[model samples]
Target: MDMEILKVDRLSFRYPEEDRATLDELSFTVKEGEFVVLCGPSGGGKTTLLRHLKRELAPVGTMDGSILYRGLPLAELAPETAAAEIGMVFQNPEAQIVMDTVWHELAFSMENLGLPPAVMRSRLAEICGLFGLEPLLYKPVHELSGGQKQLLNLASVLLLQPRVLLLDEPTSQLDPVAAREFIQLLHRLNEELSMTVIISEHRLEEVFPLADQVLLLSRGALQAAGGPREIVGRLGAGQAPAQLAYLPAASRLFLGLAPQAAAPPPGASPLTVREGKAWLRGLPAAGAGPAAAPHSAATAQPGAAARAGEAALLRCRELTFRYAKDGAEVLKKLTLSLYPGELLAIMGGNGAGKSTLLQLMAGLAKPQRGKVELGRDIHTGYLAQNPLLYFSQDTVAAELAQMAEYAGLSGEEAQREIARLLDIFQLQAVIDNHPHDISGGQQQQTALAMVLLLKPDILLLDEPTKGLDPEAKERFASTLQLLREQGVSIVLVTHDVEFAAEYASRCALLFDGAITAEGSPGDFFGSNYFYTTAVNRMVREWLPQVLTVKEAIQQWPDSGSRS
Candidate 1:
């Protein structure tokens, strides 16, 4: 068998208006029956490379070199033929789905390709069974959870029975459980069907262990490519300086004080929590040095003016909302209060109404019952889960300029702020580009910048880190910390439990339309059930109160000061 099912030979691509190539001399290959994961920071050409694999590059771009499928040059093949053999599941499911219902969406692709009714029906059933999507067959696309939509996208593509599957960050929008399930299904497809899978993703801990091959891309170039062990070993050696350092949180915590403590043995490698735990258990405990220091919680002095005034920044009383008359209530008799200088995270399963709750809080949707009251002096800012919806203007700069006008900033000040945001997000060159033309992460940053400029007393964000790479997520977290220090009250809904555990002051778990638990981040994440970070889970067995690395570090005796 040909080892290379798909190959890029010194491929280079550049948009017409861009001075530099978006992808320059990038080359890689995916073998039959192999699972490959392509990872890198945003705007590093992972998406561009995937687009090239599917032959979906725009006419304004120029391509150099060749892409071959089964030793046949892909550029020479008809578009339909290429698409039929090379199935693609896009980052945004809504962009590719054309039909209303899930059943129609699954069947539409095969029907358009002229498959017979019998073949289509059999294929659909097989795909649904393979992905555990049988129950979602008749549901409308809009009604499905973010994860379900991703699964539907995959199922729709699987109906074609393509030789190679190309997934572009398919699980980025899913909750933790749903994301894990999706990855497991993908593994089954690769094992049972021997389908070649090429996925670009940021959730490394979820996908890395399952990947047969891992490729790292940086600055639109292929920086490294090899099997998972080889690539990760090179990363551990600090060879890929430009790539984001995304060690397992557990490993990072221990390695911080004991730099060489958690390094894998000569021939052994561990990437996920389970593997790391096994590795940790095998090693004898480092001789207990000093007793851990006593816990000292910080306390704020009275009459120290709070970030925002004493006024209630955001409040909800008996909030209730339902999707339809017959549908189950999503937010049932929920009441909450948020003050300035507080960072609160709402977490739950995919269908637990986290996004719905955020929309209601942001005043984007009306509650079916009860009341949501904003303080008289409070201004509200919102960052949506799908930031693309916030873009009405054409260019990135234009969007910020419009937001500046609304915020009563002078043109010069608006320009300065826009430049500052663009610099921080590393989107300086793309400021004049259309929002739709940029990557999803860049668009998210732009939306966030616009929201921050509003400087509202309360900010509402829905999955702000959904599609971002690890580096971007870290940067966004730091930015949120700065905002909190400035007296902004943040109410964010996300599936990123680790982020919540690290950054949030308080956390609320939503289930069946109501909050089942609420408390300080430590208390909420320390619980075994509900949404909790991996680090929290790891240390829960050892230290119950440790919810974050910072907290764990502080628990150590030698640590100097707490942040």
Candidate 2:
């Protein structure tokens, strides 16, 4: 059997009109039946590399070097052959989905491959069952949520039975519970079928443990390549980029507890909550059963319920919503509020009504039996989950000008505002590029820039951090912090638990169409056993209420707690 399934030999690619190569002298190999994860900061060439796998998906760029599949040059392989052997799921599912309904979308690929009708039918039934997609098979393409569309992309790709699968941030849009199920399905595909999988993703907290190999990229260069242990260990030793600081919560916590004078012992790090928990349990008990954990938001200050009734920038009174008149209720008498100068993070499972709530609050969707009232004199701007929805102008620069013009800014003022926004959002590099031509993360930043230019008093963000890399995400947090200081009210709906734990003034769980729980960052995260941060989960025994690695280090006693 061939050990090397796919090989990239000193591959280099340069986008049209680009000065520097997007991928420069990069080379790596994926082994047969192995699962490989490609990780890096945004615009670090992960997407650029993934696009090179299939001949058709290859971007309109200058290329040097070669990619081989089964020892044959990928470029030399016939398009039909490549289609049959190499399947890909892109970062954006809507771009790849062409059919009108879910059933046709899944079957379209298989039919194009010239598979027998019987075979296609059999496979569709099996896939629909495997994905629990039977009920949604006839749903219109546009009606599916972000997570469902992503699952459909995967299901359609699987229907083709390609020998190798390439997924680019496939789970970025999925909620926690749905994402875990998707990863587990991928694992089953790899183990049971001996399939080869190459995925580039930033959501490492859940997928890190399942990767057979970890490849790190930086500015179109290889930063590190090894098993999870090797790469995470390097991160712990401070040998890698700061972008990796928050990738794995368990590793961050374990490394934080290590004495600063001594190096982290080989293989001493943990990458998941279970391993971190065991490592904590083995530590000679902190004497007291988890030092009186700090008080959480649930226990601190006036109740969030009380605050909801006060002066609110955005308020919902018994809000109820649903997508279709015949569809089940999405929100049932749910009440929430956004106070001035505060950022609230909303968390929930996929299809659990989080997006519906945001849409209702943003006026994109109307409620059936409730009222959504904004405070007097509040200007609202909503940034959709898919940044492309907000783009009317072709280029990022034009987008700013168009939005500014709509807001009645003068020509001279528009340019000044555009320049300021470009720098603030770090979109200067792609300001002149077509919005469609830039990377997903960059598009998101540009969309945010356009929204910020309007200077809306209230902002509603749905998964604003979806495509952002670690550094970009950190900068975003800073931007949000600045907004909070300016008395802007922000309602953020996201799947990023760590970001919420670290930055949200208040975190609320939107379960079963209501705000079941709400509190300050420390208070909200520390109380939840399953939905909380990795640090909170691992260090709970010591500092149960701690929400971040920094807080844990700061709260730990100076000497060994012999108590």
Give candidate 2 misplaced runs (Cα > 4 Å): 239-243, 260-262, 292-303, 559-563
The local distance difference test score of each candidate is 0.76, 0.83
Candidates' RMSD to native = 4.5, 2.7
For model 1, what is the error of residue 406's alpha carbon versus the real structure, in angstroms, after optimal superposition?
Answer: 2.9
Residue-by-residue lDDT tens digits, candidate 2, 502-563:
88888888888898888887777777766877778777777878878788766666534321
Candidate 1 CA-lDDT value: 0.76
Best by TM-score: 2
> With candidate 2 superimposed using the best TM-score fit, by how many Å does residue 444's alpha carbon deviate from the native?
0.5
Best by lDDT: 2
Candidate 2 C-alpha RMSD relative to the actual structure: 2.7
Residue pairs of candidate 1 with colliding backbone atoms: none
The alpha-carbon deviation from the true structure for residue 268 of candidate 2, after best TM-score superposition, in angstroms, is 2.7
- lDDT measured at residue 518 in model 1 versus the true structure, 0 to 100: 71
